[model samples]
Target chain A: MKQRLSTLMAAAVMTAAFAVQAQQPMKKAPPPAKAAAPAKAKDGITAEFEKFREVLEEDNPAELFEAKGEDIWKHKKGPDGASMAQCDLGLGAGVVKGAYVQMPRYFADVGQVMDAERRIVHCMVKYLGYKEEDIRKQPFSNDSKTPDHVSVITYVAAQSRNMKIAVPQKHPKEIETFRIGREIFDYRAGPYDFSCATCHGSDGMRIRTQDLPNLRKPAEAIRAYQGWPGYRMTGGFMLTQQWRMNDCFRQQRFPEPAYLSDSITALLTYMTATANGQVYKGPGIKR
Target chain B: MTAMKTTILCAATLACGAALAEEVRDYRAEAIAMMKRDFKTRGIATADRVHEDGLQAICNRTSDHPPKAIAERLERDQMESIKYPPDGKLMGDWKAGEKLAQSGRGMTWSDKAGVPGGGNCYNCHQIGPQETSFGTIGPSLYQFGKLRGNTPDVQKYAYGKIYNAKAFNLCSAMPRFGHAGALTESQIKDLVALLLDPQSPVNSK
Candidate 1:
């Protein structure tokens, strides 16, 4: 299963948390029997992880990346001596406010539709004169390292906090992208024959103790929409929708999708559109 | 009715059928093309994994609920492909099965090619009394052997089910451990014991 590793890691983290707090025999330790626990303490374990998430949410490190992103956004340091401040994020030249919610839109200039991260990386290569290959080589933040553009996307997402999701479907290409995205969402392949829909298509389902949000339903879809470009507690760095999608494919045992590729944008468009009308709670923190 | 009136009625019915067929767009063809274009092979995760088999095509298109006739046909094909253990034994050590059930390892990009993968059963099913952290995606198997009586027929069914769950249920969420070459014949026999051995925690209180 895609979540099997995460399930084990979640159990270890919770165990360590309780171990530190109590400083004695583990209250939740297994009985004299040598068998491992599965569903007996499920509710208690979920609540513990939930409580830890709330505690970390209060002191999110995403703000640090956001502030760094703002500096890069305003400063001029490209081949043309240009700044991202002038890079239009679909609103006009340099309108960052509420732009994140309305993106993955038709950009007539590029002749393609792009999500928030894709558009930001495009500006980096186009306006800043950064090589496209160089950017894609190390797009995601790992360990203590956070890339400048990832921070930039985080900065843009923060600007649209509490804003409504409104990914556009006006252009024919935009509509077509959304349709392809919906198809990919349900497409099954690989050794396990799993799709994104396998875990997320149903309601009130879970793998181990982790709750799977039904991306097909808007009410549940918001859970998938919000809290992305998030600060990962385990990895301890910022990550965007592109990295998240890439990991989903990895877990599905499929070949790696190219960074900022059209397919990723289409999938993002589908997810963003399905989550339309739900409030984007800005950049989030995750376990 | 006159022959002319009957012909007109048949023509109208055919037109309606055509319209319905046209409305159901074959999005799979275009989507598969997109995947082939955008995805690149890396490590053990190859490009061929993106291509769908006949069974996956049906399950994906129908949302895992293909028509009974089609599902039954495909399931028969799957059943024929299962390679049972040569020794005629269908059960193994329950302790070994317990370890395999708890593990959810192998077959990802990071995994080595020749290494075996875990059954990952607890991730979907509630098995044994001690493991209260089991998933609810599949029905609970808390007392599988106690309920079923562990007959030879039941043991064969359990072994077959684990080897290739799709053969038993055409669109089952469980992986075909043997069919996919993820688990060895001995490993599957062990799993059968986990579900059907009377002395196993799954069967005993």
Candidate 2:
């Protein structure tokens, strides 16, 4: 009882601090002309941002969620009284090593290609007896709270650190899913006529100093794959690739995709397959 | 006998063409169907946003580079849609334009309806040198007025370009601010002044 109370109190204080930081605008820096070194590939600001990220990565808060997720994965508290230890993640039951890097793959039992988060949610629904709709109600974490599944995903992703991305292409369905994902990436609509391609289809593009990776290219595609299931510093929330895709649609001025839907899975398959053979650098810290 | 042989050859070629066409999967149609099934309209974002316009369909089909004749024809249609501000004034306050260029707000599911949208010019272009964090997706617009003399033609071009960038170049990465009902005519005029006004910081050394 005492431990729970202290944990709750710590969470409250952290949420307050995050709220304050969220409202504060980004600090303005001096013009680049004064600090401009002899022209290099990267500008001064991007270089500075990179150095800052390296410093932050040393003490990433995603570890907090990973610990919490590990706890949830072990405990058997659901209505079905089953732990997620036996959940099959495309590598047979009870197996977790390097599972994340090969996912968005065909699961014969479910007969659908499920990404890491989607398969995690599926396990939660099938083995743990949680209602899918209830889980979907607030799948993403916010300033005040982080979902259990989000933490689980963080924990799962950490297991695949330093592993090569090898999203499967053996299944005919897997190939079709990847093809559909590419089509979705290029499909343009909405108010701006913006597809994923509009911002990310080409190389050497930016949307205000922020580099937009061309996902079609393997070298740049790793930028999208790596550092996901990240701790976003601005909101102090642990987020997953699922949340990222949902937010992308929102920013694209399009309707929200149904949580853990096939479209998101297909999109992940496309991106992950393109990034095959690249190393994933575990849970990342985001600015 | 020669006529009969020619008829048989045509039939075989037609059969081969039909077989090749059938083998190709219509992944675009499947993707659209999946989106229709999986996406739910929320707030200001509606289901109709998934449906592509005719020009958008062409751009997607051709990878943003449609044929020359077709592109020119559609570009003219886009040009004819530009609505210049009343009172014969194409320039507004450059100060307002600067603010709009810096902002990246309005027009999402979260934004309230009827609020003014930002031009978001700096998100993809360098305008005033003071803001060093400008993007490189589009060409730099620094000294837009200094390089091009601020003639009536220049002012009109700036206004029209912001109003509907597709009018100038089809398949441009730049959005059509006015044509899409995103920015008001008055807002586009301010952006014009920001580009062409001599007193604006964009023109100043």
lDDT of 1 by residue, A1-287 (tens): 33644553454465345545544432453543533544345545457656876765555567777878888888757887887877989999889999999988999998999999999988877778878888877989887588888999999999999999998999988988888898999998898888898788898887877778889888888887789889776556788989899988988878899898888888888888888899998998765
Candidate 2 local lDDT, A1-287, one digit each (tens): 45654664465355446546545665556665432222223445456546756765655678778878878887756775777877999887867889999998999998889999999989878877878888888899997899888988998999999999989999989998999999999998888878998888898787776878999999998998889998876677898999899989988878889999999999999999999999999999765
DockQ of candidate 2, scored on C-alphas against the true complex (2 decimals): 0.51
Candidate 1 Cα misplacement greater than 4 A, ranges = A1-28, A31-46, B1-25
* Candidate DockQ scores, in order: 0.49, 0.51
Please tell me the TM-score of chain B in candidate 2 relative to the true structure's chain B: 0.88
- TM-score of model 2 (first chain only): 0.87
TM-score of each: 0.88, 0.89
Best by lDDT: 2
DockQ of 1: 0.49
lDDT of 2 by residue, B69-166 (tens): 99999999999988876688999999999999998776678877877878888888888867767777788898899899789899989989988888
